[model samples]
Target: MATNGVHIIVSGRVQGVGFRWMTKMVAAKLHITGTVANQMDGSVEIYAVGASDQLAQFEAAVKASPTPSGRVSDYQATPLDPVPTFKNFDVIG
Candidate 1:
């Protein structure tokens, strides 16, 4: 897909779960640079930048396993204006 800055919003049963932490771990393993956060609206928000192949890996990582108590109803991703300066992924609030 050759994505630039990839933004994703995963909905359903995500808040209060370990989604963000798990995302950080996978992102680190894949060398994805971005941020993952728990949205107030009970979803998980992810903003990551990397190669398209890596992004595919990232997407799979996100969907493969959520928290033990988490179940995703739907998730959407969009290509963002490239931000190539990012370095290392993190969990934000």
Candidate 2:
């Protein structure tokens, strides 16, 4: 079965540690597509696309990981129309 793509923007203590790397690892493990990057507001934004179950798995992982020293709070998600172009999940600059 195919799942819809989900785009999320998380805000919190989300930069300058290992969060982005961790995100890449998690996404790779779950076979997701998109990128994770640090925003100017001191929060990390994760844009992901994949099956609903897989995206949910990444969500669960995000909720489970021990946030880095800079992390504070996570925002909500904004689901987007599926873009079937991301070949693999990555950490963007």
Candidate 3:
């Protein structure tokens, strides 16, 4: 299967709001393999890899912020060459 990747940077009340955990859950549900972390600049960064359709769903879910407490003001997803490294989604500090 052809795989794709995306580097996402989410801003606005993302950190300390369980955003990373929420992302992990969503990614796992979407079968996306990657990592989500809190950036030094008070934003959340995610690297996700999966099929194009799955990645699209993951992006939408991340933007929606499944957790009510988390608020995603803005986000940017950049396409990347898929690297077969991640075996599962994780929340990283």
Candidate 4:
């Protein structure tokens, strides 16, 4: 399996909405390893590393479902040239 990575920034109504936790759940389900955190600017930032297809699926899911309380108005995902290493997915403050 070829490993890949992405850096995602989700904006709009994402804070205090379990977005990070939900992201962690999705990442775990996809066998992705990385971290999700609430940025100081009120956006959600995620760094995920996994298979290319899985990453695509993950991105799709995130955009498609912004959780019950969260409303994702916009998002940007950038492919990482050199993927980072992570043991598991986590939610960080």
lDDT of each: 0.80, 0.75, 0.86, 0.88
lDDT of 1 by residue, 25-55 (tens): 8888877898988888888889999877887
lDDT of 3 by residue, 1-93 (tens): 779989999898788777888888888788999899898999889999998899889998888885779888998988886465698898888
Deviation from truth (RMSD, Å), model 3: 1.2
**CA lDDT of 15 in candidate 3?**
80
Off-target runs (Cα >4 Å) in candidate 4 are none
Which of the predicted structures, 1 or 2, would earn the higher TM-score when compared with the native? Answer: 1
Please provide, for model 2 over 1-93, each residue's C-alpha lDDT reduced to its tens digit, 9 standing for 90 to 100: 675666666666567668888888888888888888877877777778887899889887776553555454666777776455687788887
TM-score of 4: 0.94
Q: Which has the higher TM-score value, candidate number 2 or candidate number 3?
A: 3
The collision pairs in model 4 are: none
| Model 2 TM | 0.83
Candidate with best TM-score = 4
Q: Rank the candidates by lDDT, best first.
A: 4, 3, 1, 2
Structural similarity to truth (TM-score) of each candidate = 0.86, 0.83, 0.91, 0.94
What is the TM-score ranking, best to worst?
4, 3, 1, 2
lDDT: worst 10-residue window of model 4 = 61-70
Which candidate model has the greater lDDT, 2 or 4?
4
lDDT (Cα, tens digit) per residue for candidate 4, span 1-93: 899999999898888877888888888889989999999999888999999899899998788654787788898999998899999998888
lDDT at 48, model 4: 91
Task: Give the Å shift of residue 44 in candidate 3.
Answer: 0.3
